[model samples]
Target: MRLHVADHPLVAHKLSVLRDAKTPSPTFRQLVDELVTLLAYEATRDVRTHEVEVVTPVATTTGVKLADPNPIVVPILRAGLGMLEGMTRLVPTAEVGFLGLQRDEETLEAITYANRLPDDLTGRQCFLLDPMLATGNTLVASIDYLLQRGARDVTAVCLIAAPEGLKVVEEFVGDRADVQIVVAAVDERLNEKAYIVPGLGDAGDRLYGIV
Candidate 1:
């Protein structure tokens, strides 16, 4: 698995506000949308495209267009939902799918409750939207799930990640398939309770509030 940490002044600035415990939900949501859009630019750098010939006002020219079996964007439920709009804003024509996987706080395991995706994703390029990558269990499970469905290429877009979690993902993914992780920042560590230390607290809660 390859990891890419977005390097940009704008990305850094917005992320600082997002890390603030004092930031309100309304503003938090807005920043997430904007930040994700920026990150989406990097995440989709190698997105599949094919050449096409088009007629312009001046003359005919060749250009690239998104390839067939349009890339699928699957935002893990709840917190991941917060990132959907931003991702789609960048790839408006990409197909949208949903996967509901909640982390079991007690065991820190990912449990799949719902999913809307193609049965056979043999050649599909999938992008997963999830805000945090703390323990990496959820992402590992999600990636495995996609691979089981025959998706050989998968990219996960996250706002923040922990080194431990990235290590877990890398260990689990070795030589299996093509996978990439794109994140805004990699925080210090994961605390005892499995929360990222010196990191933004509970992205789902910050994004949508507690139920």
Candidate 2:
């Protein structure tokens, strides 16, 4: 598994505002979209592409296009939904899928409530979207699900991540498959409630109001 923590200044600027408690929900949502787009740009760096022939008025030339099996974007529902627009804006032709998993607060286990993805993802590069990475149980389960369907590779995009979550994902995926994480920031740590310290609060609540 590989981890890439975005270090751009614009990412920091937007993330700082997103973390402010006084930022209204409207502003918070907007920042999340902007920040996710920035992170998405970095996340898709390894997406498969193929060279193709193209014709110009002056001459014929070669260009690169998304690979044959085309990547799939799977947003982990609710909070992850908030990131969809930003990601799709950058990859307009990519297929979209949905996976709904909620953590059991008492057990810290992730339970699948819904799945709208292809039953077989063999040789498909999959991108998983989830805003905050705290305990990482949910992300681990999500990746496992994709692997079960024979996904070729999986990359998770997150706004903020706690070290604990990174460790858990790394250990769980040791030499297992091509797994990676692209995050805007790796915050200090998680609090007692398993929330990313200095995170943008509960992403779902901030984006859609407490539910």
For each candidate in the order shown, give its overall lDDT on alpha carbons: 0.95, 0.92
Can you give the TM-score per candidate against the true fold? 0.98, 0.97
lDDT of 2 by residue, 1-211 (tens): 9999999999999999998999998998888889989999999998889999999999999999999787899999889999998999898888999999998998889999999999999999899999989999999999999999998599999999999999999999998899989999899999888988877788999999986
Q: Can you write out model 1's per-residue Cα lDDT over 91-205, one digit (the tens) per residue?
A: 9999998999999999999999999988888899999999999999999999998999999999999999999999999999999999999999999999999998778999999
Off by more than 4 A, model 2: none
Candidate 2 accuracy as lDDT? 0.92
Q: By how many angstroms RMSD does model 1 differ from the true structure?
A: 0.7
User: Stretches of candidate 1 above 4 Å error?
Assistant: none
> Candidate 2: how many backbone clashes?
0
